[model samples]
Target: MIAQSAARHYANFKGLPKGRSELEESSLMARSTTLAFSGLLLAAAPASALARDYLVHDQKEYRAAAGAVKAGDVIRLAEGEWKDFPILLEGQGTAKQPITLTVQTKGKVILTGASSLRMAGSHLLVSGLVFRDGSAPGAEVISFRRDPRSYARHSRLTEVVIDRYNKADRRTEDRWVSIYGSDNRVDHSWFAGKGNLGVTLAVIRPKGQPEANRHRIDHNYFGPRPPLGSNGGETIRLGTSDESLSDSANLVEANVFDRCDGEVEIVSVKSGANVVRSNLILESQGAIVLRHGNGNRVERNVFLGKAKPHTGGVRVINEGQIVRDNYMEGLAGTDFTSALAVMNGVPGSAINRYHAVSGAEIANNSMFEVARVTLGAGADAERTAAPTGSRLTNNLITGQDGKPFRVEADMVGVTFTDNVTDGEVPGAIPSGLRKTGIATKRAANGLLYPTDPALAAQGAPRDLRPVMVAEVGPAWYPKATGIAAFGSGRAVPVKAGGLEAAVAAARPGDTLKLAAGHYTAEAPLRISVPLTVSGPRDADIAFSAPTLFQLEEGAALRLEGLSITGDKAPRQSGNAVIRTSALSTVANYALEIDGTAFSRLDSAPAFDLIATTPGTFADRIAITKAAVNGLSGAVLAAAAETEGKGRYAAEHIAIADSRFEKIGSLAQILRAGTDESTFGPELILRGNTVVQSGPVMLGLSGVQSILIEGNTFRSSGRIAVANSVGTPETRIIDNHFIQTPEPTVTKLYPQGSPRVLVSGNSIGGDAS
Candidate 1:
């Protein structure tokens, strides 16, 4: 009878029904029959050998109960709020009788306010709990391994939810989940709203451990996350940069990433021999970047961009990578999402740099409505070496217009065969090289798949069904069909022109893209609307005159991915890179500069805000992922004088994930003052590397709150943060002050009011 039941279950698993209710009912029935058979086998054992259950209501009871837990024991947490409770779960259980920690009622037990779990055991399971609306501060919310000789082995975490578990400052670095053990499984979990600075889920392979970290992360839901605007914000990272060469045989499959746009790489594979397959990425602004791995496999995944800008496909960098059997739809990215971007590797590159792509096999992938599919990206000025021994075959690509394949002039030894495309291929490939299999076209009703029979079998498997909510997320339902679904289509490109002409022709929300060239404007360009001007990593823009870009009233500019070089031979005295005029309205404005570089300026600030009107304010100024060098003046300065009776302030300043070298001579890097009536900037200067030539002075007269965390400051002079009113909440924690004197915080109030929190900072040494 048990064999008959098992056969029935296997048959149902292979041919499951399509509807959500039918699948759920079938799954439940299967589990029930299996459990009943297991119970029948256990009936013959002794009563003392039966699995035991312990109920715990609070942290105190949980601690007492955990101590007595043994093999085949189940600890059930009561339906209540576990606030600020740090749980250390340690146990030993056999593979057949694993220790389980679960809630009495799933989704009823809430863990909040620094409540965390650190597991150290083998064959243990933690399931059915919610962690939300709170923080663990400096620690991960869910950690598999404990400190000082405790490590988990063969453990599993299922049906767990970690949402919005942030630090106090929201800028401190702490991961939501850290897996640091061998053969651990984290499946059927949901992670969302991880707003801090770290990977949402990180798999670590410790040094000197011979065994691989063979972890499995499957059937989980990674929900929406706002852009961190910097690095170190991947949804799932296999290994760290230091461990990039290690072999971590991990598997990440059957998951859904729903708008998980945390940073450039949605899922970063840093270690070798990992498999990322059968996942659904929906409307995310990054690719599955194989940053530092070899012999990794990325297959059978689906990327549904819905024509979202910056939504990307697979990006290959290192060698021995295989990307095949995948489906992509509605991608609107250029270099990052070019269907398949084979990056150009620098010669003698380190692990961090783009490594040479050799022995890579990209096959049997299907793309619809994508941007340019490129080979040898990032090769022009960087002079990255072309790929070798890479083969592209059996791919199907269809787009609206333009070239389907773009190959750099330097690309060599890349073989293409049996590829089918509706658009024109690049000129690098010979006309008769490809054996086309299908003449694909888009559906007339705007669906992802084509209605014509000629294109029906071009992409993913024809038997597969479209992705559904039940097939994704924490609830793992068996897929009825094998095919991946197509997403909606939209495309926005940066048109080609001169710098000024492109800017003139662009409307609001358009990105004016510049290529790799030297663009010198005749005069300072006046920007009056919200616009984005972006370029490649190697593009350079120089100004003949000072103040290359001017911001008028109600003007906002997002400068991205460019190298800005100010002419050291000044066109005029006191020339700056960017100058903002005094505001005429009381509305708050902003300037966001990302992935840019400013260098070789004689004595000018990067941003010179001339505040003539007192009532006007720039609300948010965020400069992230930039490199600034050779600045002999302040990087940012509020003009010394103010006009009118009201006050002028620049509030909410964040400069994170940037590098500053040889800065500051005549003035401080950042200079802002607040009068007694108005509040100053709420500044967060985190995760920056500063190599300064002189003392770094922070002139915060009336600042509201300042958080300087995780910054490395290498200087020989004393650093001073002088506050006039002494009312700001200042916290200077976890900063590495190397070869520098101890930082002094000066407050004008003699009563010692509004004291600064200064701890966990290492002075005169490296802090790592």
Candidate 2:
């Protein structure tokens, strides 16, 4: 066991000499005295494992000293930046007493990456060095050999800085630092602007036997270099490919990221556990991740963006992981922030046929200015089972550029709920305010509203709710931001009848009210004006009133109220509630569907909603609710196209709520035509209860992507969600599934096969 040392802290010191002569003189004096003493010590039995500490100044001396050192010895470097030269330590040491390579000066000491530090040892400890000016093609500044029999066990690398000050080589293979074997600790380090990755822990063989390597990387800073765009590098990574079958268990925690080009990766592993927590990421492309090897955990990180929008976020492929309690923000372009976005399907080749994301938990995260929270779609996903056994809950969210969140409908055991959305406004509401409610389900403490739509009209500051819940009051409102809710009378007020009234009559800034009742019909409520909607659960009363509820056409609508329902109108037919589109053609409704509750009351009939419009009416809708239920005919419905190339297509929708049940033939369904005309449609479902339906709970066709999150499901159906051709991507995750059969959990078809990811859900089903 390594003895724990006090945590090291750093402060910038401006006045440090940058001359080599002084360092050379100091090195000569220290070496001459050390040599004189070495003769006296060698005369005796040389107690304490024949150890020696050499003071190296130049690259030549450093290399010679390292070769001469014994297994249980050390080589301490003098304080100074040594540009362009790397020292490799290929030695062996026992567990009891290991070799140590250290830097005595806490000041600026650099080991330029002229070469690589390849280690093939049983024990090695490296600490307190700044490595810059990387060289060699695809060569890491410091790397270790991949050997199952030998490893850098009980090794510690502390307080090292790797950057691009010396000069960077544009090689795919060269990274800032690389480690092959395990049982190593890399802590309190800084990495910036290197290569594909700042730090990597992978098997060099590409494919090999299962070797157990473990590492701990903590308290590091990873970001881009100065002047921006100089070196587009990624963060840390841990993985092994089929070429190298070796697996490693690693822990990455408490790191800082300012901006990076690539994503942090945790890829292929045989069986291992990795945990990431309490870090900060700002203005970076994102992190690449693959937890396929085994167990992993990611939690408690803060992410922020400046002027530019972040490209991507954390992506998790075939693996079981736990992700929770992280904050994300994209100040511009709403194209950032994804918590646990899964890329590939399951781990094993044959197991992927089930369409499941086995064993993952995503919960309690705050997001803002993100286009889509999750994304997955590809050819490998055909007939594949979406991710399964995941739970999502109690997260606050804001913004909808791409789509808030998406998921595969066929996913099993994914739940979402207990989230809030409060957007920023410039002065008044811009065009398109009324939101549309997507086909989604949820359960518990969810507040979905365009709370302050007008606040962010002309590039206004973002509206972030300070307090998540109202401890004292049963109802909650946007906290005062010093700006009046009405926007100094410049804003108009939202009207009673859905989005049309808000757009036609509202001004640049205004507020509106919504009555509480099954408010579904006004299909596509559009609003071209600015407004706000505020009312008590009892005060506002509105419902999808059969024919009257269908939203008006070509109107930018912004509607907010309580207890909103997306169930299709009560058809004149039999006991089956319309699971498809009951009310269609609220033409051209660019509405912001906010503050609506979606649920199925115990006393209400089961089949109350459906999607028959075939991509008609509901367009550009955003839904936010407190709860939801799936009993009433497919929680939310997507229309199927019958005719036309691209005449009418449903695109850009969202749903958020709690208390959503999973019942009947379809819970959340989407459908479309075969051609490209039916493309470019997306749905983001977040923070809601999702449960099992009777048969085919969710059905879809001809669409782009679907995101599901934070809900609970009962689990008893055929294909918890089913989709058809034209379905580009589907992300089913962060939900709960109980008592579900393996067959009924999830299913997907060809033709627009989506990249299915089932993660972060609590599952209690019979997969067998």
Worst 10 residues of 1 by lDDT: 482-491
Q: What is the C-alpha lDDT profile of model 1 across 505-587, one tens digit per residue?
A: 55545667677777777687776666777888777887776677777644667788998887633544556677665333322
State TM-scores per candidate.
0.59, 0.46
The lDDT values for all models are 0.67, 0.45
Q: Point out where model 1 deviates above 4 Å.
A: 1-50, 380-383, 431-457, 465-467, 474-768
Model 2 misplacement above 4 A: 1-50, 58-64, 79-86, 92-97, 107-109, 146-150, 165-172, 195-206, 225-233, 243-247, 263-271, 311-313, 331-355, 375-384, 400-403, 417-768
Backbone collision count in every prediction?
A: 3, 169
